[model samples]
Target: MQRRRLGREWCWIVRGGQSGGAATPAPTEKVIGMSFPAADHGWLGAVIKNAEDEAKAEGLKYVITTAADPNKQTNDIEDLISKKVSAIVMLPIESAAMTPVAKKVKEAGIPLIVVDRELESDDFTALVKGDNTGIGTHAGKYLVDKLGGKGKIVEIIGVPSSVTTMRSDGFREAIKDHPDMQVIVSQSGDFQKEKSLNVMQNILQSQPQIDAVYTHDDEMALGVLQAIKEAKRTDIKVVTGAGGHKDVYKLIKDGDPLMQATFTYSPLMVKDAVKLAADIVGGKTPAEKVTMLEATPITKDNIDKFYDPNANY
Candidate 1:
């Protein structure tokens, strides 16, 4: 998942194109670097695809790169700089590991768009993200409300980053008022189905009766369910996950007991980043440099309305 070549395949969509005024043609000489985590998992893969999809729709030139590790990502940044791509949009694997590279990109006068995760400082020209804390709060409150404010829950955490912290903190903050609803333990799921499966297995061994599981991501949520199924644990009544993945939405639609709900945390945020980054690279001024979107809770009550059978994620 290192360096991939560009492929453009859509008519441009610009402000002037759809307006009554003469269409402002898309720039041909500019290139936007679409750098992000590897599409090894569902959400991230959708992120990469949607980012590319936007670029295609806008008729923007792009050099997209994906990395499995932060070190490779750093190297990928240097490569983009050497290629002299006009701007960059990155969703870092971790905040601290990518700060130096982000800072360097900013100092080099390249317009940088930081997406989803965050860094130690504001090292980019713009930022686009979903509300991480709000997602956790939604899930936490759902679990509390479902269990009548009293139950044991296991939290499957995500990769180490500010996103993880915000989600976890928000959940705790939301549910702290309920003293009876206790989170029995929190374990790292690493945002992977396999890793969370193993983690869930280990967690199941120690906990006797868990009423719910709150996974920081839907991928991990899927993992937790697999482990529970394998262990034949009937005590878990609900599982709330973050991220608006299609399969999870289907699970809610199908009336699965454990997969009751998941808050909408879309990967499509990257699409916006790509569009704005292209404009910035072309010397256009955007009205805003920072955009943080909120999360929406998707449950059985509204699953059919939100569930898409053919979405990218």
Candidate 2:
């Protein structure tokens, strides 16, 4: 039986099978309740696609729900519980509201696999994510090296979440050693192209000596690039983005000056989470509770390895 929170709910979670040499029973009771935010961007759409593909591969019945708000997501969790799903795999829309729901899932005894964005506490069965901090650090270091540690850079931040904070923190920490590496304009792009474009445009208007730009997300990078083009700014040499979007990968492969490199953050982490949930249901205890995939710095020299023409992201 699983433990309850607030001394109210009770549920039966996974019970590990025999530890001897006996064969593990293959799980045919494949019902996974996946909940995540609606695809507000193409990158998010890739995440949903990956999750769906993995669930299908395992022959799992999925009650996948997309909620734009926490209230809707909370309701989705209740609906999944009512249906008695074997497990729940969720990428939290936000940390605060989702933490209580994640706690409830734990109390319900349903195996919960948290992916992508994190909840408030480390209460879930598994947490699979990319190294967001490393991403920012790599981008920062790359900019510093390219500019020889003396240049003006602008950063476009993402949404108001742990991701935003960690990425920025990592970049700041890495660039701290170089006193000449100055951040000329810093603003929130909110992880959207239009918003970042507007923000970048405004920054370009105010500043005329930006050497490079670092955007936390590929979508935001697109906006920043557009703003630079519209302004006809030649001073900006390198513009880097995180998130290995197909376009960004292609640009890097072609040695595009503006979209030169990006730290890789794959949406495929969603598939890994779904697969992990199914493995846990099959009496498989994962060796690690928290899995953070390494952030690879993608550059034109090695972009061929990552560039996929047919890939969606």
* RMSD (Å) of each candidate, 1 decimal: 7.2, 9.4
Residue 302 of model 1, lDDT score: 86
Worst 10 residues of 2 by lDDT: 15-24
lDDT of 2 by residue, 1-313 (tens): 1322222322222211211111112354456778878778778889888987787677665656777778877777776776677888988877777899888888888889998788888779999999999998998899889999999989899866778888999999999999999987789987788999999999998996899998999999988989899989999999999888888888888777789988888999998999898898788998899999999998878888898988867
In candidate 1, which residue pairs clash? none
Query: Which residue pairs in model 2 clash with each other?
Result: none
Model 1 scores a C-alpha lDDT of 0.83
**After superposing candidate 1, which stretches have Cα over 4 Å from the reference?**
1-28
lDDT of each: 0.83, 0.82
Model 1 lDDT per residue over 1-313, tens place: 2233346432221111122211222445566777788777899989888987888777776666677888878877776766666788889989999999987887788889999999878888888999999988888888888999999989999888989999999999989999999988998988999999999999999999999999999999999999999999999999889888898998899898889989888888988888888778767887897888879999899898888899999
Overlapping backbone residue pairs in candidate 1 total 0
